[model samples]
Target: MFSLLRSATAFLIATASLAQGYSNPGACSGACWAHDPSIIQRTSDNLYFKFNTGSGIEIATASSLSGPWTLTGYALPSGSKIDLAGNTDLWAPDVHKVGDLYYMYYAVSTSGSQTSAIGLATSSTMDVGSWTDLGATGVASSPSKVYNAIDPNLIAVGSSYYLNFGSFWHDIYQVQMSSDAKTPSGTSVNIEYDATGTHPCEGSYMFYYSGYYYLLWSHGICCGYDTTKPATGDEYKIMMCRSTSATGGFVDQSGVACTSSGGTTLLASHGTTYGPGVFTDSSKGLVLYYHYADTDVGLGDGSYLFGWNVLGWSNGWPTV
Candidate 1:
């Protein structure tokens, strides 16, 4: 166990050193947002594109893993078509860059409901204003629920594209996408099941880390409201689990098996940080995007603003 831990640690540190030289991740005030961020490493220009769902899913380009990031504003523009739940469709977007084209997978619906489905959009720029939506996702097996089949994320492993998505109702499902890059093919697998159904899990960001496919997600409540102190189980937190395959049977490095009932906690609210996004900064390696609520020292109300932490792997798992 110790040897495994050491090996993972060294790999992370070495990668950071080689991918180092950046000022680091984190920024001052006003860099905040209702963050459900996803990052894409544009190897072409050596730039890391950071994007998120809330605060209207804007694009920001950073040369270094750290600051000096330039904001490109809302990618979808103000007049983009929204389904029904107001403009809440732009939530938890997964972004990828093919060649020079940046593609974003996002959820679209009038209100947050099972009627919600995934939409695909492509842009020559990270600007959503220039993105072209591929239209509605037909993978929703059940047509009753309006907002359930949203939150689309795609991973290109080898030559295959695997798409994963789900909502707060149940487990997330994975379906293979055709190489055409727009449609789903093959069998759909319901890999990660949230058995508890306790409203603590959703948004599974699966990434390959440390020779394992790590599923990082935010658990508990998200986007704080000025409430009367949330109960212990109700506060938002970041958790993770790993599997040899993108599908399932993931366990934390501690051998603590992660199920819907109990999973490994990565980053919990340190008085304010909540609902995080994890990605590898091509310029700086692993990075954690989160929101911080300085309730005790906030900008008035006890809500969260966008915050980030540079990630370092310790003991074969990610550490903040």
Candidate 2:
């Protein structure tokens, strides 16, 4: 009865927050099905584009936040140059602008396997046919490699670039990138790891705000929802750590070292929202754009939808 009461209270709080119009994601229309969404606004036109996991990195565009979005098509219509068996479907795209060009780092691998690679593609203009595939970044993992390489995110600090990618085997790892930000230039650094419950964590996005660099990633089970799903609260949620240096020494709110599996829950299952992965955008006051499974729409992974919320800050930490 106590557990039931706690759950009911949590549900009410979540519902109230949504009704107040602050916590609920902005209304999205048109092609809303997306997973591992990475969003950015084109500076020239201020148009919103979201690249997500798909066969060739599916893209969607919208005029504004609350709008009828349109599926623009794939970034790589011909699939990736990566030739791993059963890796035709690309996954976990992270896009950022370097100088005047847009760089998209994606994953090439099948589910639950260590034989994976992080591939790169660049575009002068982020149009359907503008992308040029650059193939693998030499950041790959085989059965012998300790860490599985997937879910790539690049962060540029001053004149240096770092790529954060990893999953399952060792949670989250980082590697230095060359000036072009396309290939790894340094050895791997283990930044964050969660040893609890299958070590399920990936989709890391690093952002700099104020004076601290925030490392955010998705934790818990993220897929296989069509056939089986984790228990309510045990499903996917957003977790975060922050550091003064972009390379290492990250910690949670309580100052526990992130490399030792310390993480603060940034967002979790609330109301109808479940299993969210985030992309931070500065166009709208440090908003978090992500994909979540709407309980009302069924539990299938294919039923995931795009969502976003303008983040608030309290005591130098981000709030929901």
Give candidate 2 regions above 4 Å deviation: 1-22, 277-283
TM-score of model 2 vs. true structure? 0.91
lDDT (Cα, tens digit) per residue for candidate 2, span 63-140: 875568898889998889988854568988877788899888889988888999999999987889999999999999
- What is the C-alpha lDDT profile of model 1 across 35-63, one tens digit per residue? 45666666557665667565356777666
| Reference-based lDDT, residue 179, model 1 | 82
lDDT of each: 0.57, 0.76
Error of 2 at 312 (Å): 0.3
Give the lDDT of residue 246 in candidate 1. 76
Error of 2 at 209 (Å): 0.4
lDDT score of model 2? 0.76
